[model samples]
Target chain A: MRLFKRQNNVLPGFGLTLGFTIFYLSVIVLIPLSALVFRTSGLTWGEFVTTVTAPRVLASYKVTFGSAMIAALINSVFGVLVAWVLVRYRFPGRRIVDALVDLPFALPTAVAGITLATIYSPNGWVGRFLEPHGIKVAFTPVGIVLAMTFIGLPFVVRTVQPVIEEIEIELEEAASCLGANRWQTLQLVIFPMLLPSILTGFALSFARAVGEYGSIIFIAGNMPMVSEITPLLIITKLEQFDYRGATAIACVMLLTSFSMLLVINLLQKWSRRYAD
Target chain B: MSAPVTSIPTSNGSKKRTQTEPAAVRWLLISIALVFLTLFLALPLFAVFTQAFEKGLTVHLEALKEPDTLSSIKLTLITAAVTVPLNLFFGVTAAWAIAKFSFPGKNLLITLIDLPFSVSPVISGLIYVLIFGLQGWLGPWLQAHDIRIVFAVPGIILATIFVTFPFVARELIPLMEAQGKEEEEAALVLGASGLQTFFRVTLPNVKWGIIYGVILCNARAMGEFGAVSVVSGHIRGMTNTVPLHVEILYNEYNYTAAFAVASLLAFLALITLAVKTVAEWKVRQQLDNN
Candidate 1:
């Protein structure tokens, strides 16, 4: 059985391009990533388990995955609404609002971290108001969620926007002709059509939020067992020169995120098939 | 920008309504979207600029001119300079192979290209650290050679490259794929050389995608923090990129100076968005004409 057998296409340089692609990817991505696995392999199984499942590490996992889920959930509902508004409504400054959705993507994570820290710090602009109500945003788990939400904002809107635009008006029209109210038509017809994209967007956002570091650290207050995230724990271990501990935690995060991405890929493939 | 609002016609009755929402409902949804964007997206951006100039214009200018800030900015520019071209070349080549050809394990190849995207940025930096750090794979050789990577400019550049690796290729693949190989085939039939066919036919077709990709890649390359932070040992004027410098200043309670640097980054983000919007419009126009 042959691997990399090329079909009889007129495109020249397939070998050159493919070979270059593989070389670059291996040097830049694959080989380095496998370093994590190799380094982690130096540890005994019991030591690896203890390192990864320590109370502090476990708590960081909770804070990380929990906040990512909450943020992605929030993004889903609002993202769909935002997509609906952008595609269906004719509002002034609509194009600018559309552009602003990509701000999270364009802005650096560190800038986002500090700016959010400033805005949500007790004496800061938005935070001052919330402070009076006994609500603290910065330096808490809530702050972590807020940062993750900001980081993950564009994923759902960008994912669902095109899907919403592609929804045939005829389906809605048919639903309307069948004596469905606006709410009913939206719930039964439009929502079902949007489910797959919404799921894709949610998974994407969740995955991104889980891996996020820069934006959350400033706001999370770095209180281990309470708000410190998994990435930060890895950083902490690295700082202490505990390469073994760091690689163990990094490996866990990597495997989890990789599987999540694989699931998202399958979901997208299934959705495409379902669409066809 | 005002596309006429067309309400689907329906018999005016309490039981039946048009496809469009009532004006009140329409305005409510629009208001929700506008308010959400303003609170979440617009407000933090406003805060960046406001905080930067809080100590007045001269102070802001002085902060930017600080030797450390200047060096950090220089380092960021240098990183983007090296990273973007490498990725741009890789993106074009990868897209040419994956988009234009049918071969074995193409999906797997695409997945491998996208692998960096899903990895935590810190891990992206760590993987390199594992290779170049003092106890890492090449650490002994590198140390024996008196070479620095993990805590130096080279490590920062590698981390940025790793994080921004997928941007260009991701943007170009679907585009070149959609554009098929027909044009290249036609150019070849006319006796164009392979390079000539690529330059004349394929490059122009995907030029906007390339620009858009580069714009995004440059933004992230310059703005990357988590990965660069791990690799950069916070050497104030040496390894510190702009984002890392912002962290150092902010951590030191130099709010005004930190915001000053961050505002420049924010400004870059805005410019990136504007250029991206135009590139997307150009691409759409190209598609419509085709």
Candidate 2:
């Protein structure tokens, strides 16, 4: 046999497509992103540490990640309810309702931010009702969570909606015949099948909410060490020409989100296998 | 589903309405869904139009006609026009490679391509600044050449492109993979050149997916804010995109104009969603016929 056997692949355009793919990816995505990491590499270890661990940046991290998790958890529960209703029921304007679920995906985040802020402000519609009752939402961490929840809802609803459609009602009936009530049937039969998707939705929502800036900034009050988000802080750093500081904080966000993405991929794989 | 297909068809307006669940439970679920959408989606949407027209139709019209606002609109359209086509090309190229070929590091390549999705928009712009800003790696070289990127239209376009890079590829990848290489191979074996096979056979098959991807790409490109803001330097009328213009208007307490500008963006979103719904319906129809 020849030392190098040239096996012919049946598919065409392998060379041309692959060449364009690499060249395009490198120019647009890979190269630019590598520039980010390379820029960060210019910092010394101490400078990087001090830059990242600044008190305000650390505080922003808490608000950003904390509110993101809280909002995603909220979406995880309510989004399922929304998805369940959409999948299970027929009603007037159902198409409009289904389309409306993607409002956050379509609307600009800054618009969402300002609109949410306006309605939730003390003088505004919903906030007026709450204000007399000694409850405030806008300019608080609550507003951050609200904005996050608003933007994050679609991730959960869209993710779980398809899974709900795929869910076989026979299994629910089977559970019922075995004397399980609706709640128990959902808890056991339905919930287990839905858990993987719910988690995936939660992760997606968290990923989006954590990076959210335009929506949250307007509603969040942007108070130092309180409502400040990591993204805003990064922008603040860049504005002040603190390039090293900005890149370091950005690097942290990049690493954290990358890990979250990894977990999401694994969960998706598990869901696929379990579904089969 | 493993359920009795004969019992009912899936999707809207099926005999599946009120499926064995109790009336009260169904009503409750419906109420929750309605109330939630009303509060979160409908309220904000209503508020935008109401606040925009709060002063009246004339004021809103005047707001849209303001010089800075006009420029912002122009800038947004230009940005989307540039980034969407660029990303469309990149997306189709990447999807062609990743979907149609078996290669080493394919998964890693895909992950890299998808990297910007999870990236913070602020970071998306910040990275470019690092590459092309003052004191950046190429900053000195670029300055020597007297080329401006960081605080210019080019920077805004770059940031928009970065944020929206994955849309077309994301749409096309799964569609192409599902369609597989059979039709493509048959065309090739019949003596069509590679480009001819692609243009005639593969492109036609994936046309809807491409349009769907372009719609999504254009939406995000026009709507991007945080990244573009970082690089844009907020130079009014010069570099401010619509989202940034909205922020400026609002911050100046120009509430009516702010909402009016926002209404324009909302209009874009509405059209994007409407077109998307029609595209999806068409896709479903095609799937059924096939």
Candidate 3:
């Protein structure tokens, strides 16, 4: 009877829920990703390499990964500062400031792109002032970075803000009482504790920026081999009915992105162990 | 005080001065952040309104009067109206299953739910196209049934559903986990049927989270561009969403009309933010009372 019970029932019929979950995921996510991989498999190895490693494609990889990294790094620094302020202070208009952090979340990416483009165009308000100084913004790689930073900043801020709020102030006070200078206290005491979450935030922001399209297209100007991004290239390929070419490039991007995320996850696990 | 001026060492004075420095520095940092936000976020938003009305307020007013613009607005509202409710049901149910139950593959299912969050909207749309497009796996089957999905309203709805699937679910999971299952178990033990317990107990508890998620989902659905653009086929009056319409006008070099329609979408975003604020406030209030 015990053997039969053990065989028949472990955790109240796991078979049913497991089956449902697998079915749901297969239908929604796994199958679609496999289709992308399957589609790309139709290409020869030489053809796949040629498709993904062309000069224009290489330039896009540089721009996408390079700009995303820079933007994520920028957000990590500033996001921490912004989060620190929001958590540590009680100030007038704090509510408003906090609310504004979410604007990027709510604003439509296309609208954000248009607005950023207009604001940074040569004849527009901010652009008019900067143009006199020969600082071009709109239709430049710099503009791409700016747009990515705009969209990615909120992710970092939101992720880090709660963590900062939960950090006890007494730890900082204790470090100070132990004769640690302010900079020393910050670098040695607070930063190490917050490092993992910050890294996670950076990874999330970087991933988001790499895949961002709507907010970037207008600002990037889509100049081939220059401001053009990988996502834009994919769109172009699709428009031209180059299905095999698009999938080939997409596979490369997907593989690179998956690896990067995996490394970041590993780092997060390491940090958790160290903290413990 | 006179005695202190002489008695206080220079080191203490420096320490005091340095302490005040952070306050001043804090103010400076805050000002810089505020100024940047005002310029980048606030001004550009204000510019949308200004540009819309610049060619005489009458021009924009007349543009709003256009039946096409009104229809686009109506279409966007209807889509949001339909999609938000459907997603709410899915999100809440899924969150309940994942959070309250100790099921196999629960963690994997949670990750699957969040997959839409990480995937690009462009890809999200393409997945549907790959499934329902003329060359898709289901294309023949759907065609045999005379079901039109691609370049049609159904395509847009499916795309919206894909992108916004995580919002309500993401919102509810944490809330439900925090609330725990004790209350639901009590209701179950009290002889309430499953459906009755869900309505009388679970529904009330998760209402705010659901509302928050709905607002967010509606906002994104209304403003969704990349996914909708691919499947829309840009059929001006029929399949044109507000965002797509804005793009069409911009492409046609009708700058005034483009900004006008863009401003309308922006207004919808503003309304969403307002609702979000209220929902957040209600959640905070409930938390306090609890």
- Strongest candidate by TM-score: 1
Candidate 2, after superposition: displacement of residue A195 in Å? 0.3
Compose the digit string of candidate 1's lDDT tens values, residues B1-290: 32323343332435544676887888898888888888899999999999999999999999999999999999999999999999999999999999998889999999999999999999999999999999999999999999999999999999999999999999999999888898998888778889999999999999999999999999999999999999999999999999999999999999999999999999999999999999999987887667
Worst 10 residues of 2 chain B by lDDT: B4-13
Residue-level lDDT of model 2, residues B184-255, one tens digit each, is 888877878878988999898888888888988888898999999999989999999999999999999999
Would you list the rank order by DockQ, best first? 1, 2, 3
How would you encode candidate 3's per-residue C-alpha lDDT over A1-276 as one tens digit per residue? 363366532112234444554565566567876777777787899999999999999999998889899989988888887887766655678777777777777888878888788889999888899999999889998889888888888788887776665556566667777888777887897788888889888998998898888888888888988999998887788788786777788788777667656765676676568555
Candidate 2: true interface contacts recovered: 0.64
DockQ of each: 0.61, 0.59, 0.31
Model 2 segments more than 4 A misplaced: A1-11, B1-19
lDDT of 2 at B217: 86
Each candidate's lDDT (Cα)?
0.92, 0.88, 0.77
Each candidate structure's TM-score, on Cα atoms with residue i matched to residue i, is: 0.96, 0.95, 0.89
Cα shift from native, residue A171, model 1 (Å): 0.6
TM-score, model 3 to reference: 0.89
Per-residue lDDT tens digits of candidate 3, residues B31-113? 76667667656787788888888898889988877877877777777777877887787677677677776756666677677
TM-score of B-chain for each predicted structure, in order: 0.94, 0.92, 0.88
Q: What is every candidate's alpha-carbon RMSD to the true fold?
A: 3.6, 2.8, 6.1
